[model samples]
Target: MLRFFRVIAPAVLLAVTLAAVFWGLAIGGAADERTLLDPGDIVRYGLPLSRTLVNVSIAGLIGSVVMAVWALATDRDEYRIAMDLAAASAAVLTVASAATIIFTYIDVSNLAFSPDASFGAGLAQFVTEIELGQLWLWELLLGASVTVLAFAIRGRRSTLIVLIGALLTTLPLAQQGHAAGASGHSQAVNSLLVHLVGAAVWLGGLVTLVFLAKAVSRDRLALLVSRYSTLALLAFIGVAASGIVSAWLRIGSFEDLFGTGYGQLVVIKALALIVLGAFGAVQRQLLIPRIATGERGGWIFAWLVTAELAVMGIASGIAGALGRTATPVPQESAQDLVGSTPAEFLTGDPLPPELTFSSYFTEWKFDLAWGLVCFFGIAFYLAGVIRLARRGDRWHVGRTIAWLIGMLMLFYTSNGPFNAYEQYLFSVHMLGHMMYMMLIPLILVLGAPITLALRATAKRTDGSWGGREWIMWMVQTPWSKFITHPVIAAVIFVGGLWVFYFTPIFRWAMSEHLGHQWMIIHFLISGYLFSLTMIGIDPIPKRYPHPFRLVILFATMASHAFFGVTVMTGDALLLADWFGAMGRDWGADPLADQKTGGGITWGIGELPTLALALVVAVQWARSDTKEQKRKDRAADRSGEAELKAYNEMLAKQAERDAKVGPRR
Candidate 1:
């Protein structure tokens, strides 16, 4: 029966996605003349009045809710009962709205053909016309049911994630033609929905698969994992291919691909996916088998998965560009940058419109180079301290510092600087963002508490009382509170991305020697928040109970997904081209480019976030198991030692001052 599911599950999933894709294309390509309204009538008004939000209500809202509730029931295990309840509730709320939401879509889709009516009305009519009937209601039930069953065999989050992906197929029925991104409405709805689903399935499933595999046989785990991995790979390929093809249509030509700011950004995103795919291949071939071999292998596999998951975050940022507009060229725009001196570039004035960090350092501005060097030198200094702490009480501070210095120099001499340059110039910004937000933080968590610091500091009792008290207070008071609140960290994670991309200050971050510095900041801020959110090896701030944390995580993801969709749907330029005449020299339309960027951001961006959220929950739950074992061992040791010492002390007291030496 399990084998039957193993084979049938993926096949069924692929068929649904493929059928939905084709159905979308047929009507989308305009082969079917029975649209909500005639193009001829709409063209008279010169507007694509077809865009609507109802599609999302069907695919994301309805489908997601159903999947969530069903997952709750299936995931009702000893470890996650509360999680099951919350998810089931969410599913009830989201999926139960089907009757109402589906009616809204059908009403809009069947509206009469008329260009004279207001554009808003046309949009409404089109959305209402999409038939939301028994088929979808039943389909939603089946998808959620399958998801529940899948989670039963697998786990909770993994089951609903399967539905997340499966739910997206319903978009076509909402009158969103196959080439979804072509129409802004389709793009808006699917932008975050598709990727969110895929990421949840891939990243979350891998976490489950890898850990479960650890307790079982290599061949069994391998075969089971491989089945899922194949699904993930296919999903990734589907998203990438669909994205590229959609981009080609939206962008029009090669000129639009690189000749414009938005186009170049998309190209960079494509390249990043290629690189991630390359690394994924290496991980699959070299690492999974190694991990399946046993304990050490499992650790290595954990790292490999960490690295892969980390890259997905970076990929998400680049993909966010799909919702942005191409930089526009205005009348009377200057062709060249207005920089007169070195200081001009530093001030973000007279800089080229297309200026990037890597381009600035070469022939553009040599004066700022040394400043970047000094900055990295400082980061190395900090890293040295952390590395020293990594060894706990086992190593000397001086040796650790020296080791870090050597690593820093090696980092500079090898491929580090080049990669840093790329990051500053393009999607590298997002990559570094991931390192700060996810990878390095995870590394720090695994490094554990500063055992050496605690020990050495314990010997410093002769030092000033104020300093010691300060350190004590730092640990006992606000320090943990500042980082541990899940809401606080979630805000930072989502907000930092918003702030960097939405301001003129972002340009400053992109240029000058400060570009790398800003990247470092991004990495640190994100890393700090991410580590706090996940199961770090070190002590965390006040953690919510597992049930609460899982709920919050799910809500956090939903909010951000909606945020991306909002960006995709709106017709606005995020950054506003604060570069004066330089902004106008780039002929493309900023609003359209931003919409494309936002669409991609909304649709695909949540994938990594959702994946990370689920992984964190699973890892935290698993850690609870390990922690119980650790505590049991420590308690046993302490008990034995106390008994031995109590007997010895009793003998001494009996011979001397007696009175029951230390209470046993």
Candidate 2:
């Protein structure tokens, strides 16, 4: 039965994918007449086909590497098989991405192929000069890079890096999916990205498992299945949530779910998802447990997975078509608005109402990515805490509260009124920055999530890896040691202010969604590292002496103040093109707003700095007290033997002096 599944799964996947693509194209009007020049039949059909291959290959590449790192033991045959699968899939991804680049260029430019220098030059100009072409070119290069890395590197650490690279290869593709200069653009892009990654992991992991069904030893097979089951569950949730967001963005209304061709395709995909979810539930609840007990469920599991893969293929096909399908509501409605403001042109939203104290809490702009992150973060942290309590282990309630507060603050900074106005108001942006980099980290570092995770998660006695093992490995690695160093963390935290604001990075973050997300992640992580170095309860590679830590804190504060003062006193506006161009009817002048931001940098930023210093001072005093008590305990245990020995030595010395006194 397992052998039959191994043979049939690929065939079924190919057949269903092709059928779904054609069916969707027919319904979505892929062949509809248009005003623009058509690139011929090759591009009309070939582009979506190539895209389907790209999605499948990316899934295989990322999923195999993830499974290798998270499930299989490093020394086992299963690990090597997974790596080989990754390499092969990466190679396919490279080819598919290259094909996608060609198809996309042809589709966008309506260009004909020619075996001549003129054609080559045109292609080069398109890739180098055009935005759409450049995105695909970057994706292609990344795919090729992953292909080589996957083939050459098989060590655990290197595989992890390769997995990250594979994941990154999907970013450019994600950005290119929907028009960026539209309302809800950020949510659409974020949702699509998450959906792609989640689907890839779920689809690719299952495919790899089917391949490994015969290769893995019986004892390890159960463990690998169990591990993959957990990953699939998480992936399922990501896919479901992201799918809903994406569908909502495109479909606009529930009635359209049946009214429009795009919506109908979405309905089909959603149905496929439900089917996949049902299969996944059974595997997680029934098959996994049975397999773990040394039951022979491999054949049954393989067949079920094969069926799921076929369904996934249909969804992938529908997804490929959805990207090309025309929606009922035009994606560029914001751009189409009459007399749009610069803010509307750039950020896809109108200039927000003037900043007010109450507006910060009431005005809300949802950032789907961070919203999901905070939701899941708080949920998981609370679950861990609950698990510990249920096991009769005491966890500090304060830590849990701190974690929840931190997550809430993160959500607010990323999704609240501050986010709504940050693009238009420099001061608001600065407020969000300070909160992200300083206040939020300060609260979160006190939570000690890693410690909670270690205590709450069950230890895997089997050779297979799990979340705890992965987290432990990450913490103990040399890279973690280097990043956690006090000097390094301090530099990243303090130096980032000058580097980010003074360079094009500020403009990039303001203008591009991906760049903005990257800025948040970088600052948050840097802040967490710096906070950990100073007053973190979590274990780290090394701890700075209290006095040195104080000095570091003071130095960092000085640097931070200097940065703020520079911005405050600057004659010119930072990213004057962005903030100056907003053309707001309310708020302070651009320079004045910038100075307000600088004041925030200097004044508001100092609050966290002072709190950290106080915490460090208290810890230093407690350390001294603890040391004194340790000495007293030693004296009590030794009964003053050292003092008695010293007295005897003094007496011996006195006798020697008395004997020698006569000669003197």
Candidate 3:
């Protein structure tokens, strides 16, 4: 089956892409008027819709390539590595060529017509130029990689060089059209582009490192990973520096930063990246050395990699949103996305901000309950973190911080942004999911709480506190078992999305004063459960079998994606606000909302799938380890007993000599 997929998937993807190309060209031809593309008119052509669809297709192709690579790696082939790289190169070529071709099709007159799209042809031109240009660099590397790989594998450079040359022709041979101008973009947009590229080089390289670690020499791999760690750290620092500067430059005032749509979304993006960078820093500073030493650092490396990957995914999401907002779309006011009453939508403002702290405080007790929960939760976590780190055990601090961040993201902030956007607004919802699903899971996974709990317990040699023991007992109880089961976790994750969306809960929550709070709860539960089930970085008391766990992850993700594509293709208005009720126009169209959600799911799903498969495969390979240990126990036990007796004999002899006199 894997073999079949490897061969056919890419072929299908390439076919779809070629079809889209011809379809686009035909669409271009059918328009009677000259559709010459100028950079300014790029925005006028309603090109984001076009660009987004293309994004969907391109992402699918990349996903196919990733799956193909995985299949190649795991297949029992001696030349697995060589085959995988060749497959990857081919995938990269297909995507890059197709992206560039769209630009070639555009000419000049198309620019003048866009309403607000004049800024850079609706940001499509901007993105197309960047991705298409970036492909050339990949082409070069693909060639170099093939050359080196062929030589290493086949003991010849000639075939490799020929492959490299063939890869070169994959570059844009068609007309090099004028790339979009960035002049109209706010400084934030300009800076974001630069940050994104830097981020891609850093995070994408890290991802490749994780995937290739098994094949590379351990010593060399350690050094290579260290280099990447350094690179990631630098990129993070750049993200922080550029992000803050860009924020200040783009936002006009506090209102713009907080009150306005662009600013608030940017704030969310910036903050998520900040948390992600901090997570990466821990990996670079702490884990790399320990891992290089080849000692068992327990689950630390796994947590670090998962956190980094999650961060990378969220960052990609932020980049997507940036493309949407770097320049405003005229006639598509903020009100439209928010689903303000038609009066408000047509007038160009968000739904009146009704659910404020004041409203929550009015019903003081319930509000107080939530307030206490978040406050104490954050405080307890942070305090424990500081205590553990100070005790020279970093795990406690790491896990606590991760849990706290995840809690805050899901239980508190997810909804504020959700409400702030109004309706099932696509961009805001994406941001919300990024927070709840991606960012929160990342932090929790990094914490590796189970391992931390064990270490913290071990360090206290005295075992003085029975109080801590009770808490530990409860955590390990059967009831706790039910909650943490992979199947249950998967159910929570897969079930939560639909329950929220399909039920009136989604509507009532959207309409009522406490709806934001409800949304937060939904996000937290769904996000945490999802993380716990699939990429599970936290300690597991008893885990499901490797095969079962893998199946669980795959199944849950499939569920999520099933809904996701359904959401995208769904013409039915799932949410009342999605239809833009009368005067209250949701800022973005329902179609756009559906489309954006699908894109997020489609783009982000592949990484998790691959990660899950690898982890599960590792688990499967180790299934007999427990039995082997049991069989060896008696012999090991006797050896330890003998060693213990020898140590005692030495201690006793030393004591006797000291008491009696040195010479005797």
Task: Specify the highest-lDDT model's number.
Answer: 2
Error of 2 at 435 (Å): 0.6
Most TM-score-accurate candidate: 2
Separately for all candidates shown, the number of backbone clashes (residues 3 or more apart, or on different chains) is 49, 0, 25
Q: Alpha-carbon error at 179 in model 1, in Å?
A: 50
lDDT of 3 by residue, 1-664 (tens): 2223334333443344334333332332322233343343343233323332333322322222222222112232312443344445444544544433343234322323233646445435534455444443344344445434433443222333433443233222210111211111222333443354345445445444444455544454455556566556655655666566556655547776666555655666677687877777776777767666756542455456655555444444443334334322232323335534553443233344333446322321112224334555565556556667888765534456567776565445432444344343554565556566645665566566554554444332222222244346656878668878888877777687778778888776654323544676666666666566555655545666677787777776678778778777777766645435534332456667667766676556445545656756875767578677875796596876766888999999999989899677
Which of candidates 1 and 2 reaches a greater TM-score?
A: 2
Task: Work out the TM-score per prediction.
Answer: 0.33, 0.95, 0.37
Error of 3 at 535 (Å): 4.9
Tens digits of per-residue lDDT for model 2, 1-664: 6667667887788788888888888788874656689887788888888888888889988898889888887777888888888888888878987888877776777778777888788888889998788988887888889889988897876787898899998898789777878887877888888888899899889888878887866556676777888889889899999999888887889898899899999999999999989988898788876664645676667667777878988898898888778887787745677887888887887788888888977899887778889988998999999998898999999999999999999999888987898899899899899999999999999999989988888887656667788788888889889988888899999888878987889888988889899999998999999999999978787777999999999999999999888888888988888899888888799989999999999999999999999999999999999998998888889987888899999999999999999998
lDDT score for candidate 1 against the true structure:
0.44
lDDT of each: 0.44, 0.86, 0.49
> Residue 235 of candidate 3: its Cα lDDT?
57
Q: Give RMSD to native, each candidate.
A: 26.0, 2.3, 24.2
Arranged by TM-score with the best first, the candidates are: 2, 3, 1
Cα error, candidate 1, residue 7 (Å) = 88
- Residue runs of model 1 more than 4 Å from their true location after superposition: 1-459, 465-472, 495-523, 579-611, 627-664
